[model samples]
Target: MFQLDPELESFRNDARKVAERAFAAKAAYWDEEEIYPMENLKLMAELGYLGITIPEEYGGSGAPVVQGTIMLEEIARVCFNTALIAQGAINGPSRAITVLGSEEQKKRWLPGCVRGENIFGIGISEPGAGSAMTDMITSATPDGKYVVLNGQKCFCTGGHVATHIMVFARWGKTQGPRGIGSIVVEKGTPGFEIGHPGPKMGGRGVAEVELFFDHCRVPVENLIMAGDPDSTRSFKRLMSSFGPERVGNAAMCLGVAQGAYELARSYSLERKQFGKPICEFQGIQWKIADMATQIHAARLMIYRAATNLVDGFPDPLEAAYAKLYANEMVQRVTNEALQIHGHYGFTREFPLERMVRDSRGFSLGGGTTEILRNTIAAMVYGRAFDQRAGS
Candidate 1:
């Protein structure tokens, strides 16, 4: 079921070793404590995984997207939570900075990120805006050497633990989409504080929190991608970087689905029914067939997206389609796998219950399945689909 191009086979082998050794060591602890896997993060850094997408000149591997996706997929099979942690820890704001940071900003941050010494989070969603990026209310006012940030951000994953945040906000007091700009804000700035963490249904190990910026002062030099939201180039950068993020979410979903399937398969083989193993029964065989089919298709979609990315093809619609399909496919696979286990799946004895909860987050995170469908439709029809048209 695993396919690696000859060019990427060695890298995949290396990544699998790391996932098996380093991630396996920390998975159970992270799950039990519902805490970030700092040990795994350190191990990834030591192995140069934290810099998967960063440039070679920036003390990074500068690996291709295929290599990166392979690493993610393998890690997902072992520990999806750590896989997600690695994905976002490495990509999220690091991508924004690598693409748009000023020379000085790049020099200041990229090295640390590459070294796994610095963690960054994206601050795009707000209390007033989730899917609607245009309605962000955070304001950044020029104050001589610094920009004074005043607003709040919600549903911010890694916001509490990150050393820095790439915050999108309106420059000055203007309203609507035109005022949007992205600036990097360091944690522990005088007026910056993370609020209580949100209670997520799953992926509990990845902390999501609200950020409060009360007259927070970030140096103007930290402004990475500045300009109105209407700027096509700026919007394009957001779109390009977003494709990887969506694919990473899909990878996590695929991992959880695979984990659930394995759980069900193991249980079916072990739990006897009447005269023999449940797995030998036709009804159980059908469930396995469907789960395997869906998972196989989802895996192909992920690989397709990764291949397109490696080829430098900007296939946003294809990326969306892959993410949407994989997200839904995994949910179905996991649910059915859970059902195959029957009553045991409903309890905490098996990981299927956790897998169910985790799979739910995939549809909601990155971009909601509904929102992604609209995006895909917009791309195909060459017209924006107003999700709020009826609302």
Candidate 2:
């Protein structure tokens, strides 16, 4: 229903051009090496694309969340890893710092993130608990002047290279989301061990790893959103950040699908079959039409989700709606694009194969399709469904 303003479109164009030049050539190298793309991250910083949502007073662009999605979509179209570098600042823990951190903390952290001089990892999902976040068992017990943390965290994306990690653990033995609060664990903190990066089929360059907090003691001041003694109210407040994260995830998927479709569109025109360009084939034409229509729909859904925010972040329902569609849509779109290229698409030379691999992870991360369905249902019905209790 709505369209991008000229300024936003200009911003999108600038990012797309930069990505085409700087990230396109290196996307394969980064995916093959599985090494962090710090150089590209620096370029993003120079462009002021990092921390697109953080306020300018904190040395950020202070742009709306929509701009962040646009930036991510453009970069992911060329290189998924480079787009992730931008996401490291605008999503997850860095974002929480902007929203929930004290003035002193914001002054200390947000600028570095905006500058791309800092990468913050999120330590939330655990081996034993992911979708059922309330079942998390990590503990953070109060000591005299510090809180001792004891737990294991898995799926800590960027943990291997992050300067700091924001970990959520139980403040006491209280279970089921209560007493769940988070604290910042600086790199090299005693008793905090970072494991080797876990290999993935996609999102290759960014490191996702395991984290251990064995009696990891940190100053009580490191605790954020921990004001309530019982910590009863912080869980919902903290998790609201995932709304924007999901929107960002959807944007990346949208970009990848568009990239694949464009490649297919070009190939169909030049690729001949039976002495005629494949573009003349009705079958190929229909596939191209479907991909274009789907991409257009996803773009609109993502922009809508990005623009209409509840309290400066995406509404969970809207984010879920956009993410679910984009996640499923990308898989279909990429496959169709690959099919259009025929046998050549299955090879690495065309980038279609890589696009298919990279596109798969978006649905897995951010939130699973199953989990997102639950989220959408909760929002629509205005009820929190406890699956543990059978109806």
The lDDT leader among the candidates is 2
Pairs clashing in candidate 1? none
> Which stretches of candidate 2 lie above 4 Å from their native place?
227-232, 389-391
Candidate 1 lDDT tens digits, 1-391? 5577687888777777878777765565566678877777787888888888788888888877657777787787767678876788555778667766777887899899877788888888887788877778888888899988899988888677889988888875565556677788888899999887767777777789998899999988888766464444554565576777877777777777776788788888998989899999999999998998888888788877777853243267867888899889888888898898888888876677777777787887778888888888898899975566575
Q: RMSD to native for every prediction?
A: 2.4, 1.4
TM-score of 1: 0.92
Q: lDDT of candidate 1 vs native? A: 0.78
RMSD value for candidate 2: 1.4
Cα-based lDDT for every prediction = 0.78, 0.88
In candidate 2, what are the lDDT values of residues 178-244, reduced to their tens digit? 8888899999989999999988998899979999999999888787766233756888788787888
Candidate with top TM-score is 2
Q: Which stretches of candidate 1 lie over 4 Å from their true place?
A: 1-3, 25-28, 172-176, 229-233, 310-314, 389-391
